[model samples]
Target: MTDTSSKPILILGGTGKTGRRLAERLTAKDVPVRIGSRSGSPRFDWEVPATWGLAMQGVGAIYISYYPDIAVPGAAETVGAFARLAVANGVTRLVLLSGRGETEAQRAEEMVKASGADWTILRCAWFSQNFSEGFLVESLLGGEVALPVGNVGEPFIDADDIADAAFVALTEPGHVGQLYELTGPRLLSFADAVAEIAKAAGRDIRYIKVSHDEFAAAMAAHELPPEITWLLNELFTEVLDGRNEALTDGVQRVLGRAPKDFSAYANETAATGIWSN
Candidate 1:
């Protein structure tokens, strides 16, 4: 059995959305945090096996937030190998940031579960930050957010809520062997979400519905890498096929509070001036 009492917590993607927030929260609580990223001190790269052991040194727990996404090809194998390595390096706890309604992500989740580490899976919905902090931000700035989506509603969870849940899972003892399907308090269509942002930002933003092929062509025209274009296309088509329309009690279950609504996210993010040019 691994002794986690004094070991530093390893957070992969420590500078990313949820990872960054979790790291901040943990650090504020005086928890020893080892950021694991290609650019971090004692760099940890998911594609480079040679760097794993160094980051794993004295790490009692790990937050696995795969880059690109876990739904991409070969994510399961890579995550599985990493989990095994964590066990070998004396890491006893694993918290995986996963995607809801993704078969590939589920496969990766299974690999983490079987890794012999005390595991907690945070299977989450589309992030509310996607508008302000991610790929859609440029579109929001341009006043037009076009996508290959229609009336399908998604329960967009706040990344902060995800970070909070992860913090609990990593530090608390009751979360082991639990799978938390995190979602927002309410569901909103892509168009509805844009409208909320527009209302919050006091701007005119149009939500244009384009065909999947057309969206792909536009992304390619913008010179996005082929892999990224492919991943976006897959997520827009397959993952958003009305599969994750309902709200889950993950936030309430884990944190004993209702998840933040999209309106709150939009309002708070609008204050940051991310939507304004």
Candidate 2:
């Protein structure tokens, strides 16, 4: 055994998708888990660095899943500084949730690797959960989805697989200093993904491909928070330019299995009555 029983693991962004799943998985394995959130016991907050140390106390491993994303401005500095502190506080291993094709996220990954702690980076593609748990949820439930993405095929990844990959890296010994580009086994365009979701949900759904300006205007009309709206627009416009259309064998390479299919995710999520008529 690797003797992780000596100290608990701190999971940053424990309320978010990957973090939440990671926490659940770790807890299921009887690994002591400390949720690093403002609502947690020690109350870890990324915007407020003072809280980090308190939450990190007695933690030997950390699952660093930054909210919004590591691609956001100032995330690299925040993560870098926190990694140093976590290592100083006796954290021995770190698993970072990073974004695919994101230069900024790549910078943060490098910082984690240089933190003098055992590190594994799960560089993931756009998540399949976006339609069920994130931005596209409402639109999917509304029967029409509009986006700036057009004909750009993305190997949309499952958060569950991301969590699984993180589990292996966090608990295993041979995964140190590795960057795994985690993605789904197949590629699907935005429209194709929505169509799959619609079929799974047993509802008639439509996808509208619009210009970036139009998408931004629609989001503004919905009173979406300005910063979030700006970020979403930037991601769709700048990041979805066919940069992540290709597939990879990262899931197989890491876990000895292929990544989950989008259809499976759609069907499973639909069974939850998320997009019910």
Cα miss at 28, model 1 (Å)? 0.6
State the lDDT of candidate 2 residue by residue for 1-277, as single tens digits.
Answer: 1236767778888888888998899889998888888888889888888888889888778889887678887788889999999889777588888998777898998888888978888899999998888988989888999898889999999999999998888777788878899999889998999999999999999999998888878988999876688678768877899888899989998999989999999999999999996
Candidate 2's TM-score reads 0.97
TM-score of each: 0.98, 0.97
lDDT of 1 by residue, 12-85 (tens): 99999999999999899888899999988899998898999998888888999998899999999899999998
CA lDDT, every model vs. true structure: 0.91, 0.87
**Backbone clashes in each candidate structure, one number apiece?**
0, 0
- When summed lDDT is taken over every stretch of 10 residues in candidate 1, the lowest stretch is 1-10
Q: How accurate is candidate 1 locally (lDDT)?
A: 0.91
Candidate maximizing lDDT: 1
